[model samples]
Target: MKRIFTGGTILTMAENKQVEAVYVEDNVIKAVGTLAECREAAGSGYQTVDLNGRCMMPGFVDTHTHPMMLGMCRIWADLDYPKVAGIDDLIRVLKEHGKTLPAGEAIRGYAFDQRNFKERRHPTAADLDQVSTDVYVQIMHASGHCNVVNTKLLRAIGVTDETPDPPGGALGRDKDGKPNGQLFDSANDLLSGLDGVQPQNHGPNIHMPDSPDHLMQRFEVGQDFFVRAGITTVNEVQLTKQELNTYLRARDQGKLKMRMEMSFLSNYLDDVIALGFNSTFGDNWLTIGSIKFYSDASLLSGTANVSTGYLDSDRHEGYNYHEPEEMIEILVKAHKNRLHTLTHATGDGAVDPIIDAIEKAQAEDPWPEAIHRVEHAGLVTEEQAIRMGKLGMIPSTQPEFLYLYGDGVVDAIGEEKGREFMPMARFKKYCSLYTISSDAPVTTPNPMEAISTAVTRRTNEGTVLCPEQAITVEDGLKAYTIYAARTLRRSHIAGSIEVGKLADFAILSESPLDLKEDEIQRMRDIKVMETWLDGEKIYEKK
Candidate 1:
């Protein structure tokens, strides 16, 4: 229904920087100016909702997220790295968990990165074995690219000492050719061939294939959580054309409230080419984003492909997992397919090479219209930042990551490496970077926490990582809104409170612009009163 929302402070994020009450007609914004102007624009049939002095801003457009993984959030034994400490602590926690379980059950846990630990060592099968032999287990590291398995799990999966390392992954065996119960980034990919493992013993430990219901539930729960935090949009990554269609179905059926933009997984670049899908193939509700690729794993896993061997481990040098030639081939393929490649490169050594591939694409024939997007563009050099901006690539980042990982980064990579950080001030002034999600179980999708961190540059413990990297709150707002719209290629349609734009925005209980430094850091003060998408009230505070 067409509506008028009045008596609210507004952050229009428009080119002219105007702020006012707005009138929504059907699915688009009919007007945004003074309250009188908005009321006048709305005819007799329109509904008026009072915003009660709350602030209205463009919906946050998260440029990178994994909506399906969110359904797996509380399903596993939550072995978050920050919760458990040493191996002993991990064992104790698992032993405690094992005691509560029946015999021969797997103690499954995800998001347990060893890099967050003081020792920076992987959790091994020996560790869980000490807890319970019958308690075969597999745990996902925080990087989401690796896992550790118990001997029983290995045996169940038919992984032997002599089992040749599968293509693109390692079995991680130790002396005398015994599987070490540890796996790296590509290791999970190899396990895809092994026996399926399910949460608990939910019937013979099968890996159930993801279905429409599985994905849709995640979208529902994930989107609900976002609306409560005043987020209006999320640009989810790791989607195929089929998955993309699922989200479209949600929008069409009126089940989806959050405005969505999705990045297609690079695995189906061929399908994208055959279908001839462009960047903005769908409506503002759900549009196609860049094609997501992973050059290497995150910094936490030693597989991040860094220039120097980590100072702590001499035997291990980060692998450039995406070989230069391989990267070139895939990148060239993406260019030919007319899809922008959004790569996840979180190490110093990986950045330049990926950029080189992009450079090659630009020089070659039939390059995609835009060379945009680098997901989790962490550990980048100043030169790379300059090069990325010049190339028009958006760096989708998670500030909450800085909140938790900042300390570990300094300890692992040294102060010099940690100092580079998100480079918010630098990006605001010099680059075309914007904020997106990296979500449900990776980190909270709250934009305000990101907004606070973006402005404060404060690490998790309130220690300032790089004071120079802080951007103003105003610009940070833009990063999550209009700049994000630019990332989704929906700038003209939904980013700002323009008259012709979609009536999609979030109503916040607290006006962040009016808050002080310490106030934003509190987080609880920033609350959502309501969320409207496509001129329809999708969520209302009960």
Candidate 2:
């Protein structure tokens, strides 16, 4: 079927291009130019879709998020701000939730940030014990890098005072040297016990299982979060066996809607290579894009391997997941096998080793087109940016971090370093392209929030962390659309509203470019009027 989209500002997202109308046929863009030209291209027997003065652009491509986890979070107790204000509120909320669960079921809560608490401290086992000592209670930090379990769960997991810290992860201890129920990074694996989902030591363990039917429901719920927010594509950056199975089930059942590029955990590196799997292993809807590695823990958790210590002594300097040589060896193996890599590195300390490994990998076996990404690349130096530019690395970062946690970051890292957080402008200067994403379930999956944060550099409290690092609104949109598509190597097929590209589009209530600097915060208020994929309207505002 042929359709001509008219009466809207069509943002092609290709070198600041805009058109009065877009001509589509059989789910692909056939032409884009003046309304008359598009109508002429459409010929007869075509449909006219009136946009009514809205703005049309490429659907957002969220390059990093955990859809399964995001869905699972929906079922868990939401402890995000304004929901639970402090430890007392957290305990009260958990107790209320505990009453609703049946016996033998673990009570899982997520999105609790201690920074928002009046006490400004993690809820220890003692605090969680107030909820229920009879059942297993675990609350995950907003960063997903840490978890605080009740004493019962600690004992159930067999983590004792004598149990030494796991390599690449740590157990928070009290003044008496006893485990305090705080598990960081690899230590989160202990929560899985003997039969639960284990990611090995590749990354944090958050893939707790549920019934297959319930998991499928969760996947669908998560997909809605993206589609409603104008995101048509996403990169599941931490794909585990369970997540892969879920995706397969969703695909086979015809329930999967969003275009997904899966980045399997490094734990599967050997198996992937043995199977001769590369980035092009799957179809457009579900492709194997990269091998994901964790160089360090999360920056928001105050555990992102920074060179300098945090201001608070209690928040110790973070540690790397692997030694420099070991990381280099692993990266080299993947690089040699012609597999793309995405390593989570949120601090200079974490970013440096990844830089070294990529440098070594390229020197050993050069793949000029290889775009190994530094996930987060949150706190990078100018020199490191220069090196990353030369290596053709993609700094896949989340600008929403600034909008949500900028003040807390400043409080943790101090003023100077915090001001340089994310540094999208510097990245634009050196790197060929930088992509912005919502590490969703961490912030929000809404691209408008990210774009607002990127262009304004404003925190939740309206403080500009680094105004110098702010990019133009158009650039921010490009980062979430075209640049992000490039990161997934799908720009030709999905990114822009150009000839021969898929008809995936997001229609907004107003053009974001029309918002003045002072009205930048209003960007988040711009609603996604409709979202289309494959020339079909998938979502429309009620």
Candidate 3:
């Protein structure tokens, strides 16, 4: 069947190209030109879609996400700001949520940042005990790099006061050296018990398992969050065995509606190698993309390895996830095996070793075309950006972090260094390739919000972090579209609207390009009216 769409701004997102109409045949774009050309391309038995002055562009490609986690978080207690103001509010919210759950069922709360709390402290085991002394209670930090569990859960997990912190992770402790329920990075693995997804220190161990059936349902719920946000393609950046099984199950059961590229955790490198799996290892709908590594801990959690040291007195110099030699060896092995690597390096100190390892990997076993990525690159320096650009590394950034955690970031790193957070303008100048993503469940998957934040550099509190580091709205759109597709190595098929490309488009209420200076700040006001994937309507705003 052939379909023609016209009467609106069709942003091809190809060098800022605009056309009058688009002609689609089944799942592929047949022509993108004037209406007459589209009409000619689509002969008889063609349906016309009147855009009615709305805007049509490529559906967003969020290159970094945790769909399963995002979905699971939907069912958990939301501890995002304005909803839960302080530690007291957090405890109350969790308690209220616990009452609604079946008896003895674990209570989990997500997106809580102690930095935003009126008390300015993490809710300790005792604090969460206020929520539940009987049932297991765990509240994850907004960074997803840590979690604070109640005393009951900590005891259940067998983490005692004498338990030594994991090599790449730490446990928050009280003055007398008692466990305080704050689990950072690999310490979160304790919450997984023995059977859950354990990435060891290779990645943050936060993906606790639920029943397969429930997880499948949660996966659907999570994909909907992206679909409704006009995101048609996502790269699941941390794929453990549990996530792998869940994704496969979702695919086999026909529950997957959006395109996914899974990046296996470095912990699974041996397994992947044994199975002879390399990048782009699966079909279009569910493909294996890269090997994910964590060079450092979470920026928001004040654990990100920064040479300058955090402003926080307790954390001071942040920590690295691996020794430099260990990280290099892993990178080299992956590189030799012809796999793309995406290392989470949120701070300058964390980023340096990653770049060094990449350079070493290429020098020893060259794969010049390999698009190894530096995930976050949140506190990347100008020199580091240039170095990454020289090595053809992709800086996968989340501009929405500025919107969601900008003030907190400033508080942690101080204004001077925090101003360089996500530096889109610097990326443009130094790096040939960079992409914007939501890091959903941490923030939102809303591209418009990210774009707005990228352009305005404004925080949720209305303070602009670094106005000079802001990119134009057009560039922001490209970051989510073409550049993101390139990051996923799916550019040929996914990014823009062109002949022979997949007909994945987002119909918006207005063109983001049309927004003026004052209107740009309100860019998120432009809604995603409808989302089409594989030439079929998948989501529509009611």
Candidate 4:
């Protein structure tokens, strides 16, 4: 059936910008133009869907996300604070949640940031002991870099004081040299039911394979979260074999409501090459993205490899997951196999190796058309940006950092440096690609809020970190839409509202483009009235 949506300002995102109506037939857009023209083309067989003079645009495409983890957060014990003030409050909440769990079930908690705790430190085994001694309780940090478990868990998992730390991870120790039950990076792999050691060539235990049904359950939860935020498409940043199976099963069961592009981890580069998978391996619904390599740790935990290190009395430079030689080797091999790379390098320290590797890889075998990306690009310098642009590399960045963690960044690395932490202006001037994402579960997946952060560069405290770095509203919108779709190489089918493209759209309460700079911050208040996928109304605000 053909449908005509009228009485609205349609921001097609095409060169023309605005249109009066959009006509859809099945899962593709038929036309976008004046209401009278669209109505005439529709004839009497079409149904009219009134937009009530609201605004409609291309659906948001989140180019980076961890769907499984996001879903797990929904099902697990949420220890995320301001709700739970301190260590005691966290234990109390966990204890209360534990009561609801079935017998013999391991208590799992998520989104626990020690930075927000009054104690201002990681929770140790003793701290968690107050919650439960018998149960093996595990609480993951909000950054997803590490976890703190109880002694019971350590004992149950057979990790002792004598246990050696993994190559890229460390086990926190007490003053007496005993295991403090705090695990960082690869150390958390001990809980993944793997070899209890880091994978041979992998970064950590990111390959937590689960049953297909379990994946479906988790996908259902995460899908709803993204859909509500008006995200019709997502680029799953890191996918293992298990994730591959989960996505396949979900698609087979018709559970995949949004378009997904999966980028397998760099650890599995051998397997990817052996399988002969290329960038265009899958269909539009689920496609191969790029090979993701973890170059360093999280910035929130101060584990990110920064060149100048932390600006404090006791200056300490963070560590990298792999040596420069090792990183170069991985990048070269992946590039040789015709797979694009997406290296996660947040700090200036880690960024060097990644840039070096990419430059070397391109120099050896230049694939200028292949879009190699740098995730986070959090502490990139102007020189690095220039190198990236010259290499035709893209920075897959998250602007929500400004909204949620801007203050923390300022606190760690002085206000002057923090002002340019994620420099949007410099990135534009250097790199041609301007992709932005939520990095959800790290921060919420609200595109409007993400855009607000980009346009304002303001933190939750209302402090504008860098007014000069602030991007325009149009740039923010394009970052989330066209640029994001370009990241996955799906701009032809997705991205903007154009004829002969997928009729994926988001209906907003107001036109963000028509708003003032001050009003752009309030874009979060503009409700997502409806989200459409494949020309079907998947989400409607009540």
lDDT of each prediction vs. the true structure?
0.69, 0.89, 0.89, 0.82
Put down candidate 3 lDDT per residue, 42-122, tens digits, no spaces.
989999999999999999999889988888888899999989989889988998998889998999989998788888777
42-146 in candidate 4: lDDT tens per residue?
777888889998899999999889888788777878887787769988898888889899987778788887667787677888999888899889888888887
Q: On residues 1-542, what C-alpha lDDT tens digit does candidate 1 reach at each position?
A: 77887776888888657566788888888888887887787867878778788888877777766665554554556677567766777777777776676777667666776766666778777787776677567777666656788888777767776777543345566656777887665556434453332111000111223466766775676667776665667776777544566677887788876767777666666667788876647775677746767776667656666675466543266655557788777877777666766777777777876777777778786454575666777777778888877766667777667776777666667787776667777666557656646455577667887777777777876688888888877887888888887777777876688888877888888688887776767653487777877776677788
What's the lDDT of the predicted structure labeled candidate 2?
A: 0.89
Error of 1 at 507 (Å): 1.5
**Model 2: clashing residue pairs?**
none
* Model 3 ranges with Cα > 4 A deviation: none
Q: Least accurate stretch of 10 residues (summed lDDT) in model 3?
A: 309-318
lDDT of 1: 0.69
Each model's total of backbone clashes: 1, 0, 0, 0
Candidate 2 lDDT, 1-542, residue by residue in tens: 89999897888898648888999998899988998988889899999999999999999999999998888888889899868889999998898887788987888899998888888888899999998898899999999999999999999889888999988888998989999999989998887767767775689998876778887888888889999998999999998878889999999988888899999899899998998889778887899958999998888888888888688549679888889888989999999998999999998998888889888989989998787999999898999999999999999999999888888888888898988898999999999989999988897799998998998898888798878998999899999999999999999888888999999999999999889978988999999999998889999999
Better of 3 and 4 by TM-score: 3
TM for every model, in the order presented, reads 0.89, 0.98, 0.98, 0.96
Worst 10 residues of 2 by lDDT: 192-201
Model 2: how far is 369 from its true place, Å? Answer: 1.7
Alpha-carbon shift of residue 301 in model 4 (angstroms): 1.5
